[model samples]
Target: MKLIGSTSSPYVRKVRIVMAEKKLDYRFEAEDVWSEQTQIASSNPLGKVPCLIMEGSEAMFDSRVIVEYLDTLSPVGKLIPQGGRDRAAVKTWEALADGLLDASILARLEATWPSRQANERSQAWIDRQMEKIDLALVAMDKGLGDKPFCSGIHFSLSDIAVGCALGYLDFRFPALDWRARHPALEKLATKLALRQSFTDTLPS
Candidate 1:
């Protein structure tokens, strides 16, 4: 398998961490989707990063889809539950974490994308996205109260997704000071950082 994405993408990092935890091997193809010369559209119609090319040349886009498929490939370290409410809970945590990433990335693009003229940029839109991130953090911290992991006792996909999101914030929006606001998440991130999977995939 070949993973096509930039190191800076949180979604890509999430997939990488999942693969690492599962002890899967794959080639990394770095691509800058933002560049006009990028060939991302050949693999992904949406021109998104983290497109996985399987052995037979089949393609899988979207980090959530890729990670779930990867968990089924090997039982080395099951990240998703087989069935029941536990599966739903883990998926919910993943959605929340991804949503946070969505908001933060949108806010970042609004503020930093060079394609948009200064007058075209909307501070209001950026503020709204930031607000979503803030609310998501509060909910994540509350949901994680006194738990060893986001979903339950075992470290799962929930923690992987949340860790990637927090790592992105640290890489792009450090001034947000999320750690101070949500100490529980900070603790979780600290623990995650110690993992070889998380450490190896840290965004450059």
Candidate 2:
């Protein structure tokens, strides 16, 4: 098995973290999807990163699908709950975290396009996304509450997804200062950073 993605992508990082936690061995191929030479389109029509390729099976796309499939392959460090309401809760957490990342990336991309920034309407759209991120941060802080991890007690996919989202914010939007606004999230990030999986896969 092998994974193809860039280190800077939060989506890719989430998949990598799950792979590490599960102790799954696979070749990490760094592919720049933006590059003309990238084979991303072959595996994923959307030309996205974090495509997982198995020896004989079809390649898997999307971090959520890939991670969920990988979780089933090993019971060792099960990041996802087996089933029931528990599984749904973890999936909900993942949706929120991933949605936060999606919004953040859109805003950042819009900011990079100076012409878009100059347009009042486009700028307003960007602002809306930023506001979404702010609200998501507050919700994440409150959702976490006093739990050690997102789901409480054992560390799960909720932690991995949220941790990667926070890490991406730090890497791309350092001025956001999420830590100052959410101290509980700060501690969660601190604890997650200590994990070998996180340390090994820290975005450059």
Candidate 3:
């Protein structure tokens, strides 16, 4: 198996953490999605990072899909639940965390464009994304009140996704001061950071 992505991508980090937690070994092929030489389009029509190529070159796009498939490969960590409402609940948390990252990445990229930097419309769009991120942090904190992990006591996919999302914010928006606003999340991030998986996959 091979994992294709950039270190800076939060989505990629999610998949990498899943792989590490599962104790699965795979070749890591880092690529710059923004580079014209990138082959992401061949494996993924959307030309996205975090594309996984299995032994036979079966390409898996989308971090959610790849991570879920990887979870089934080994019983080591079992990030997602097997069945029942528990599975849905964990997936819901993953969706929320992924959505938060999606918005943050969009806003960060939009801010880099010189034209968008001066355009009120673009700024408004970025503001909306930031608002969504803010609300998501509050909701996550509330949902995580007095819990050791996001979905339950055990560290699961929800924790991995949330950790990656928060790490992305720390890497890109240091000025946001999210730790002060959401202490619960800060605690979660701090604990997860001690894990080898998180440390190994930290974005450069």
Candidate 4:
């Protein structure tokens, strides 16, 4: 398998962390979707990164889809639960984390994308996205109150997704000071950082 994505993407990092935890081997093909020379569209019509090309040349897009499929491939370190409320809970945590990333990316593009004219850049839109991120953090903190992991005692996909989201904030929006606001998340991030999977896939 070949994973096509930029090192900077939190979504891509999530998938990479899962693969590493599962002890899976695959080629990493870095692609800058923002560059004019990028051929991302050939694999993902949406032009997104984290597209996985499988053994038979079949392509899979969307980090969530790729990670879910990967969890089924090996039993070394199961991330997602098998069924019922447990599976739904893990997925809900993933959705929250992914939503945070989506807002962060949107706000980042609004504030920094050079293609947009100064007048075209909307500070209001950026602020709105930031609001979503802030709310999500509070929710995460409340949901994770005193737990060893996002999904209770076990290190699961919930932790992977949340860890990647926090890491992305540190990489791109350090001024947000999320660690100070939410110590639980900070603790989680610190613990995750020590894992080889998280360390190896740190956002560049």
TM-score, per-candidate, Cα-based? 0.98, 0.95, 0.96, 0.98
Task: Give the poorly placed runs of model 4, Cα more than 4 Å off.
Answer: none
CA error at residue 168 for candidate 1, angstroms = 0.4
lDDT per residue, candidate 3, 32-137, as tens digits? 9788788789988999989999988899999999999999999898899999999999999999999999899889878885554355447788999999999999
lDDT of 1: 0.96
Query: lDDT per residue, candidate 2, 53-110, as tens digits?
Result: 9989579999999999999998899989889999999999999999999999999888
Clashing pairs in 3: none
In model 2, the clashing pairs are none
C-alpha displacement of 9 in model 4, angstroms? 0.4
- Whichever of 2 and 4 has more lDDT, that candidate is 4
Model 1 shows how many backbone clashes? 0
Off by over 4 Å in 1: none
- What's the lDDT for all of these models? 0.96, 0.93, 0.93, 0.95
lDDT of 1 by residue, 1-204 (tens): 999999999999999999999999999999999888999999999999899999999999999999999999998999999999999999999999999999999999999998789999999999999999999999999999989999879999999999999999999998999999898999999999999998888899
Model 4: lDDT of residue 132: 100
Candidate 2 matches the true fold with a TM-score of 0.95
